[model samples]
Target: MNLKTFLRGIHLREEKELAEKSAIRRVLPEGEMVYPLSQHIGAPAKPVVAPGDRVLMGQQIAEPDGMISAGICSSVSGTVKKIEPRMTVMGETRDAIVIENDGQYTPAEGFGAKRDYKSLSPDEIRTIIRDAGIVGMGGAGFPTAVKLTPKNPESIDTVIINGAECEPYLTSDHRLMLERPDELIEGLRVMLRLFPKAKGVIGIENNKPDAIKLLSEKLSGDPQISVQPLKTKYPQGGERMLIHAVTGRDIHSKMLPADAGCIVQNVATAIAVYQAVCCSTPLITRVMTVSGDGVNTPCNLEVYVGVSHQKVLEAAGGLNCEPEKLISGGPMMGTALYTLDVPVQKTSASILAFAHDPVAANPSTPCIHCGRCVSVCPVHLVPQMMQVAADFDDFERFEKLHGMECIECGCCTAACPAHRTLTQSFKYGKASVNRLRREAKAAAAKD
Candidate 1:
């Protein structure tokens, strides 16, 4: 296991054997299941079941509102079929809900229990991960109880976990770390009892040597857990470069990682927080990775979280060709999709596609200042001076040269040799500095 490397990133082309020896499989739920209502990242869950309601499967049709909200179940059992807008996965349009399918997925009351996750409690596993609306399925849906709400909770210490699934045709967190490494080490000992003076590690990346030998043989003798391995690079599972490549620390620039003592998380968000706290289940189904080159039979499914994306490319055996662009989560921070009737949520891990080339690959020239976008910046910032201060509008010297800690992770438009979209000009200079900080907080709340 000679892995431990990290320092700068990029090494692309790991199309990940299309679907890394496929296996997850079980999707079923096509005639409806939209849900949306702003999948995580705070303040959205408000529906509470509507349109001819009837719901069931893990119930709770949206509720949480304050403390960094998150709650929304009902991954199919019946009716609803109407909450509104649609589209999502950042293509826009919002609201969702939908539902419909009555092919009876039934099961809802205290969902699939098999508890004794060492007798729960860290406030009963953060209220079953805030009522099983679990977020952070690792594409940044955030709000997994606001990363276990640690605002100075005694300055954490360490937890990491990220399994460094360094993206490139994502293998749904390396097949959920080679098929649930002991339910992600029992959800990393239930998030180490919510920061009991932390210490957990588990990084994993030496190209998944059988998921670091099955989580170093289920963290044998676990001296407060350890694993490590890493070095597979490319946004090395981010969260501040996996807490500076596992514990060398450097979290700063508007801090987090619980202010550098650490927290990180994501080995499929610790096995979806151990199936949302000991199998009560909710976050409607995840584990995607259907792979690219316009898929023919690339695998990894366990989908459901609102299915579609062309029913996971017809369960991965349909379009062996006709693709020309259709991402969703892994082609380096995936997204570019306009169709496949969008759906999957809880931060879908990979749906790709890309085939087109009727010949027209030209425009993308200027930007030869050649620092290879500041030598493959993995947050070293200066993405060519934040895309030349966002093409000259100079957003206050591009937010004083930090430019919102650019985690756009397109790695300076893939180390531009002048194919400079430079991460879409720092994503339109961070959407014109968050629309001028929401119009200066709506003119200071109208005085």
Candidate 2:
């Protein structure tokens, strides 16, 4: 069978076998749920319910504070214990809503009731997604409503479902595709309603033959939807990379997928959309892959949002021992967690515990100027040049080298013989450059 893949991506040990076969099981939150206000990419949600106010499951507790923000819904029936600072998986503390789960998950009126999407207008559908507090569950955490409402929906000719789940050790999306294939399709159909001209395609990596076969069989004889199996490769699920591989399209740093006549949603995100639009169920729970050699049992759990990482690890039969390394998301692109106290948010994909910390154990040495870093970059940027620009504090040189375009997929660092921290350098450079730009913009406004 002919397969599709992007160029210049490194091939690593998939490491998915650890948890891919595990069926999804609901892992209820046993402790107080801590809902971070700034869970998505835009402005943090504003609390609408005060402390001591009683809330039910699926109740809207917070409202969007800005144009690009997302709303927040309570996942359990309880009293608003307090609004306080809480830590997230990224090792940062932000103001959050602390709810005392009363054990009885009482649903709000109209919650979980079935609704026909066919009768609703596009605007109504978009409003439903916004109210459900859905975001890009595959890791980006961008508000799903904002993604659905592009500037020019008419230009959208292809709607892509990102089922690749290409990140190592992350199988939440893989399981979602297998367990809820119909719901996934329904969500895509919901999206196709907004862009009546667009045809939907689900892109799955060939690594998941079971998922590909299942979705294909379910979608048999469908005119507007089909499944396309991609060649197994790291970062194949990256927004730009997947768009390129599936549709032969290219989008740069300044462009959105809509600019390329496409819009993409994650496997779990699509299923959530279906639930929100059809069943009136908010994004309260999602599948998470908790696996690695450090954990005694590897499993895909449907965990409540705002559940602590500590509780999640326990739900997975606890760690085999104290892990040398712990990460949120996947090994290639996930952030290292300093503490297990961090709460899972809408974008929480997986919790990885490793008995061995390879990167830290093998300290970085001076770069040997091997061109492998240059060759393996999916975006075709030169890592060595970007590293020099980053090290020398030359933002202009870094921009010229396309440092901003780096997806930070850890490809260059993985390909380097010298074990350099190339991805981290680019990340730091990108943040610093953005800060400088914001300062410059402020100065111009004063003038």
1-447, model 2: which lDDT tens digit per residue?
558989989788998999999999997776599999999999999999999999999999999888899999999899999999888888788999999999999999999899999999999999999999999998999999999999989999999999998888888899888888889999999989999999999999999999999988998999999899999998899999999999999999899999999999998999999999999999999899999999989999999998898999999999888889999999999999879998889998989999899998889899888799999999999999999999899999999999999999999999898899999999999999999999999999999
Give the poorly placed runs of model 2, Cα more than 4 Å off. Answer: none
Candidates in order have lDDT scores of 0.80, 0.93
Q: For model 1, how many clashes?
A: 1
Task: Please give the range of 10 consecutive residues that has the lowest summed lDDT in model 1.
Answer: 356-365
TM-score of 2: 0.99
Task: Give me the displacement of residue 266 in model 2, in angstroms.
Answer: 0.2
Index of the highest-TM-score prediction: 2
* TM-score against truth, every candidate: 0.34, 0.99
Worst 10 residues of 2 by lDDT: 1-10
> Which digits, one per residue and each the tens of the lDDT, describe model 1 over residues 1-447?
556655787887777876788878787875877877788788888887779978888888888888888888887788896889988867899987888888888978878787776676677788888888887878888888778878775688788888878888788788878877888888888888888888888887787688788778778788898898988878888888888877777765587778787888788878888887877786788888887777888888887788777887888887877777777887767777878887888888878787862112645877778787787887777787777888898999998998877888887777676677878778799899999999999999999
